[model samples]
Target: MNDIRLYAIGEVARRTGLSVSAIRFYSDEGIVAPADVTAAGHRLYDVHAIARLEFVGTLRELDAGLDDIRRLLEGRVTLSDLATAHLSRLDDQARRIRSRRAVLRTIARQHTEAEQVILMHKLAGMSDDERDRLFDDFWNEISEGLEVSPEFLGLMRNGRLVLPDEPATEQLEAWIELANLLQDAGFRREVKEALHETFSSPGAAIMTSTEMVGVFERGGAILVRAQEAQRSGAPADSPLGREIAGLYSAHMGEITEIPDSPEYRAKLAADVLGIEQMYLESLEEAATSTDPYTRYQSLVAIIDGTAREAAEFMPFAWLSSALKAVASLKDS
Candidate 1:
């Protein structure tokens, strides 16, 4: 050991990129003891000490603490074990950094201070479980006292509104708007009333069955035709519009077992229009996805369009006066 060549702390620092003082601190902490002391009292490191010092520098780069380094040097922990622990910690730190970056990007794009503050509070502090719970609670309230189909219930539960691990600006905005909509008391009341009325109406049983799928499919076809007519600039009271309207009215009459007379159509239109604002609000909440609210809106639109077309054929005075009175009463 005495005959082995040695390097001073300065030489070790030059080779390993560690400062002389850092080597001294590690030596003082017993993390890497000096191989020998010169007669004049300067510390010297042998080949083994040189290797240990380099290892210590590498661990320090990884942010390992003095105690951990001490344990590693003392053989109390294996290098592999220490490295695995450090890798786990690094992964957690990376996740946190990414999350913070996402939040900053979201804030940078906000149009108002109030929006920024609210989004920061809602999203930055929210956990995955908290987000899930919020959706569950909202659906519970919306479905309360309503006899929804099992399939519909399953869709509600599983169609989660997930925020990505690193959310984009539009996704953040979507989450914020959806959360706000879910919490609006007036919106909730209107949605509940609409659901209640739909499920309790005479046609409710038929509408909730698998058979309703056929009704929706037929209505979707009619809507496509109506959309074509609309794009061609056909007036709502034109022949094309009247043809689509007739198909729609016949379908409703067949499904509801109600006559397609002026009074029946007027009452149906009033009921359907009463829920129009709520349906529109739901569509807004689900604006980013066609599948989210299209089916529900299609059903409402068919009924609404059919009733309005039927009313158009009534005497001008009765159509204007009587329909307005019925719609106002139903809406209230």
Candidate 2:
């Protein structure tokens, strides 16, 4: 005891690089009590107490709470335990920060409205299950009382968008946009009409889900061919284009069991063209951004991790032009 060297609070503060009041505060808090007190009521600390103050200062610098530091100092919690808890907290904070960053970036890039900024923040922070539920409401709304087969409706429901666990900013933006589209009344009505048209057509009652899928699969292939032809500088009236159009018309005829005759082709062509125009007009009335279909499809692809460069809607556009040419009997 006589050999022990004790220092005043000022010397301890100098040694530990902590402020004198901070050392006093910790001492008062019983986190690092001083070793001795003079008759004058001045605080004095030994080497061990000064070292403990240094430890407290380090933990404080790391943002460890006072209670946690006290518990650690008291042997109530291990350093490893405190570190684990803090790491988890940090991870959660990082996700929130990332979400906020995504929202801010979207607002800046899209010139988002004040109301939409609130919406984007809410949507960007949604859990996977919550996001799934949003789409569930959409599927239920669109499929309710529709004559579409269960299998077809199942296909629609199964195409739910899934964001990655740690989604990128673009993925978050896509999700927000998609969520907005899903909730848009105009978009909902448009999808319902499309579903009704495709599944409630004349011959649809006789077509099995497999048959419908086959027809669409075939149409998709023809669409691919039309796009290829377009890329190769082939006009919509080119021989290859006409061939693609004929295949598409035949498939359309299958939808209604109408024979692939010239009159049927002309009517289908006119109807397709008219519907495209009507769709665009309706989207405008709905206050949709430019080419909402393409944007919607692209956002879905991005969220689902299947994003590709072919979201331009060019396949259908090319096919539409070909259908028009075939209707006019202009197979150049």
Candidate 3:
């Protein structure tokens, strides 16, 4: 004891960059006990005590609680173990802080108080699982009684919309909009109607094992030709337009087992136009965002442009008339 050097509380504070009061608090709390008391009544810490106080100060800076520091100092827990646990706690706190910051940023950008509240509530309340379940419910409802292919169904399921833990403002807004759309009864009904019409139409049976392969191959070819014609800036009523329309009529004719006559072609064109209009309207409604980050505009444009090019072929009412015609012909 006589050979060892001792530091007063003031000296310890200066050495460890801690306040005298903090050192005194820790000492009173038995976190870092003094080595001994001098005859004059000053508390003194030995070299080992100084080192322990330094460690305790570091832990405090790392945001460790007093109780946890006491546990470490009392040898109830090893320094390595305590430090590892504290690091994990800090990491969890950091993640939470980041998530909160993301939400706050979104709130800050909101133009209206109602929007802010709604966005905050939505983002804060929904977990990833809950979000996923919402999409599952939507797809299940829309796809009811529909003969969607396994491959296509898988694609739909895999494209489930989910917000990241720390989502960007645009992504959060997009997700919120998507959720709102899913909850819309009118939108659901419209989508269901479209699906029903498409699947129950006359040419729907064209998706047969042998026919489907041919249809897909031919469909791809038709799209390519229409895209080329669109690129060349051909008018919808021009010869090029008729060529695209002819390609579609021939495809529908093969599918419906109908003769490709002018009357049949006119009816096919009408049906095609109706379906195209439905899709364009739906896309426009869903993608009505002014946000540049929303991918809806580009997606809608691509689909609309493709449909317009296909419409150039002028096969208007194919599905409805062909189905009725084929049924009547069968009856006769």
lDDT of 1: 0.62
Candidate 1, poorest ten consecutive residues by summed lDDT: 313-322
Residue 94 error, candidate 1, Å:
2.1
User: For model 1, how does the per-residue alpha-carbon lDDT over 1-332 read when each residue is reduced to its tens digit?
Assistant: 45488888899889878899998988888888898988997899887888888888888888998888888888899999899988888877765665566466656776658765665556545677987787677778878877767665653344555555554444444455455556667666676676677678877766666567567768667656755665566665654555565565567778789766656546645654554445455545544443423433332222224323422332222222333333223221
lDDT of 2 by residue, 243-313 (tens): 98888887777777887666776777677667657755644444434554445655676777655334444
Name the candidate, 2 or 3, with the larger TM-score value: 2
Candidate 2, residue 56: how far the Cα is off, in Å: 2.0
Query: Which pairs clash (backbone N, Cα, C closer than 3 Å) in model 1?
Result: none
Q: Which stretches of candidate 2 lie over 4 Å from their true place?
A: 1-3, 144-153, 195-208, 211-294, 308-332
Q: Write the per-residue lDDT of candidate 3 for residues 1-332, one digit (tens) a residue.
A: 35498888889888888899888888899888899988997889887888888888888888889988888767799888988998888776765565566466656776648765665556545777887787788778888887756555553344655455444444554454455666667766776776677678667655534546556668667756655665566655555666566667778788789986766766765676587578566556546644322333333233224323444542223333333333322121
What are the models' TM-scores? 0.54, 0.59, 0.55
Q: Please give the distance, in angstroms, between residue 232's alpha carbon in candidate 1 and its true position after superposition.
A: 42
